[model samples]
Target: MKEIYLVGGAVRDKLLGYPYSEKDWVVVGATPEEMESEGYRPVGKDFPVFLHPETGEEYALARTERKTAPGYSGFVFHTSPDITLKEDLLRRDLTINAIAEDCQGNIFDPYGGRQDLQSRILRHVSDAFSEDPVRVLRVARFAARYHHLGFTLAEETRQLMSSMVQEGEVSHLVPERVWKETERALREPSPHIFVEVLRQCGALAVIMPELDNLFGVPQPKQHHPEVDCGLHCLMALEQARQLSEDSEVLFAALVHDLGKAETPTEELPRHIGHESRSLPLIETLCDRLGVPKKHRELALSVARDHTNCHRAMELRPTTLMQLMQRLDGFRRPQHLEQFLLACEADAKGRTGLEQHPYPQREYVLQALVACNRIQARDVMEEGITGKAIGEALTRKRVSALKQFKQQFTTQDKTQ
Candidate 1:
């Protein structure tokens, strides 16, 4: 009873050969009061949990409890000196996470977790899995992480998730928590699993009702052999997931064309101005998910300017300079790379766009490079405000800047 054990993700990740640094300890013979006696501080506001003062590690006292509510919000926790470590393992989300390891590296697998791990299946520890709708998101995330590893959802768990969605357990989840899980899943090696799970469980409609409208909306046959707006969106989201796990970029990509579902037409299959229309919705979603203000603004900018990549090619030098100024001297190579990647992913995800080479993209990228090399900030430091610079150039100067460098135009090149 004196022995404590490491359990859950630490053990599961260890077996999978993933770096398992964060450790969760379950004390077998300790109560919260006993842990307090050992100088551990109780910290779990939502549940009974504590932290070790020296290591700052979390320690949840072992307990055996029963449900008082019908769902996850209904739990009644009971901790005791008599409860064993096995009791705590049984109450976890999945069999893979239910396994425990002691300090000496001895593993305890009372629920055939090792076998399920070997088989690459995520099975719930008990019927209690149905009680927590959040498990649905976790399962989806696990599917994304373990898909290449050959993991599949267990039948009972899948059925339970479907049932939970049908029962509207999704509303029990807070927006921030759900967004955190969804964003994490999107950042995975493949987030298609997350989408598929959301589609199957009916949870996607709960959070993103706008997407549900795209289900059967067909696209123009000439461009999209994929058939519908939803399918195209799914493909785009998959591309986004593969491109980067940057939460803001990924979220923006996923909903960048959301307005298309409402604005689809026979002539231009994807609704024009959909990017602009989606900004407010994305902002609301970002707020609901508790994303930072800076990230929200960046994502909104990506969505708003997604269509502007083409327009950038036609910009006169003054206009180009204005655009660069608007970007506030974003001179870093990685900044340009991230913007181009986001633009390219958006472009590649669409169909029937003019095949004209993205000259503006190339031009802007080169301009960004030049801006860095010449230290555009130094130009600004030389008493050149963006408005001041814009006023300095004449119509002729603007035209010349847009065109090839003629020596006659070189006169205006100086600030």
Candidate 2:
């Protein structure tokens, strides 16, 4: 008799008590004809996948995959009634992800997935894991998601991933798919692990060479205790998570220092004018990944003005307003908020600074609030017309910001 089983993440999550966000099923000994007769809607283009008539949950037939080409598009799948559950499970990327649970709640873990789960280890199921370049990204993403659980990659699995990277497997992945995995990883609580693991296996060099170049680049020790640009990037990401839950801000924090890697080596440690220099690299990365506009915009603003934000207290009122105008923060206050978080992440990402307070955050935010008070309508009513109104309004906003700065200066004197 044909049977259905809950497979993949649902089974793994249930075993770990992690709460399932999605449940995927595999139908054993089932044909497309049988599935259609039961009213399951066909959905998958490359393989036999059906949506349940009632629940709409995805259920794919037990199948196996083969590598027929170079990249993610190279996969060829074979789904047949003759394929067993073990065969389907073996074709999966990781052992812990290959386990399945039946309707009767009997788990089919032929590959020692359960033991690996108990040990909090992520191990590849078979040599077939090397066939798909995307699996390396998936493994890194899983590491980002599960690092808090103490999950470590198996030594052999890491070796296999290294080999895949050496063989140019990572280079074959499409940019959009790479970004899809990367975006999800950047949103996780410990996103730094994603960057670290990919770098470990050499995938970073292929997928994100600009980021990989940051590894040995040094920063001023006083400002960046982490010293290394790559390590600082990860540190900033960790700090970004604490300041903002937005994935855009997290991504911005990660790329904020990309230009530092390009700083003329003759001027070591000090990354002079790195902020503007980061813009081209950010644009290149965004275009490559087809990153969402929201993420791209936030990252661009952070890359261009993160230093301005870091030195908020020192910027003149005119300069501060220009910075705000450049960021489009007058119309979208959240953009400034995102930029401030990225700057704060950079500030606190260093060693011995994790718990240090960032006064620049409040100072910049207050500057934004003071600038927001100047309205174009109010300026227009002052008999200012045409482009002159814009200039007049800008003057008023700068004046308001000057006053705001003075109040802070006065408060400091009193203290």
Candidate 3:
């Protein structure tokens, strides 16, 4: 008497008329031997999860879990053939994700998932939600994903998340899981909402204290009408959503001003050297969270040089050349684009400045073009043939940039 049901995200998204990417199934009254004999390949290490031979979709056995200790990995699963669909659904994190549908499209929601879905609420399935820490991140990510649809966290669920943070459950999350969730959130339509949700539940302090520290810190009102450093960072992230959908660029924008949180009391409204201060904090956060190399590198570049990027028109030709060389702009033009987008986001993120023009992006781009047009081959053709060739190339690049700057100034005066 085995039955398979479409479950979790597939069923939830289907009910909401939202697009979904993958389908997962829950098999009741089935054993590993039965699935294997039917050509299903066993894949689950800690539980009985098999892949459908034809569709390649995952089909996990209806199972129950009990907390064995603490944290996400502290759960022990019980997968018996007698495990009912209701019992399996009870183990899920959210009511919205616990709904299921049979092959004949029969909806079986032992929980009020359909009701919650229609109400646009994100609620926990049961008190068992407290057992796993990763659910906090998942809930925040869902908030980010569906923020435009007016989805709100249920008050009870928010309380439970806050309790989990207070109980130190979130501290047990592994670095890989944290980075994975953060990276996914960064790609969401309203990614800043993810941070807001985490901060609300007090999870941000445990998971990303560096970011949480920015909340109450002050910034100059003239430069950042938002005033609070954390608010401005989130605002920057929102602006980044308009400029680029790339997660690396968005992440760079989110963390570019982390050093402001560490400023001295004497520097209350003015973060004099916050850019340099941000460098080590960014490195520490990235290292602790096991962030990927590309994300870390981009964040570091934005944190250290975003101010310089904002002042591109004021930098001398030699300084501009040095900036491009530091960014390896000629060898990695795509990375340079990412850097500029992050800087633009930072410049326009302030309150009352969302629509402000940022000419520095074009200035830096033109400067890079001027320097790039001075080819290394042209310099090598002079028979310098050594380290002098490198020096000569630098000289030519600076000279070309200076000429371009002069032309740019002349054109500006004419306008």
lDDT of each: 0.71, 0.90, 0.94
Where in model 1 is the C-alpha error above 4 Å?
69-74, 221-225, 264-268, 310-337, 350-362, 371-390, 393-415
Q: Per-residue CA lDDT of candidate 2, range 1-415, in tens? A: 6989999998998999886689899999999999999999999999999999999999999998888999888988999999999998999999999999988989899999999999999999999999999999999999988999999999999999999999888888999999999989988768999999999999998888888999999988878887999999999999998887789999999998789889998999899999888889988988888989999898888888887887888999899889888888888888888888888998889898999889998887888888777788998787788999888989998999989999999998999
Q: Which model is ahead, 1 or 2, in terms of TM-score?
A: 2
Q: Write the per-residue lDDT of candidate 1 for residues 99-122, one digit (tens) a residue.
A: 999989999999989999999998
- How close to the true structure is residue 17 of candidate 2, measured as C-alpha lDDT? 86
Give the residue spans of candidate 3 off by over 4 A.
none
- Give the number of the best model, judged by lDDT: 3
Model 2 Cα shift for residue 165 (angstroms)? 1.0
Give the poorly placed runs of model 2, Cα more than 4 Å off.
413-415
Report the poorest 10 consecutive residues by lDDT, candidate 3: 380-389
In the range 1-415, model 3's lDDT, one tens digit per residue, is: 8999999999999988999999999999999999999999999998999999999999999999989987779988999999999999999999999999999999999999999999999999999999999999999999999989999999999999999999999999998999999999999999999999999999998888899999999988888888999999999999999898999999999999999899998879899999999999999999999999999999999999998998899899988888888888999998999999999999999999999999999888888888888787998888878788889999999999989999999999999
Number of colliding residue pairs in model 3: 0
Cα misplacement distance, residue 44 of candidate 2 (Å): 0.8
**2 versus 3: better TM-score goes to:** 3
* Cα deviation of 249, candidate 2, in Å: 0.7
Better of 1 and 3 by lDDT: 3
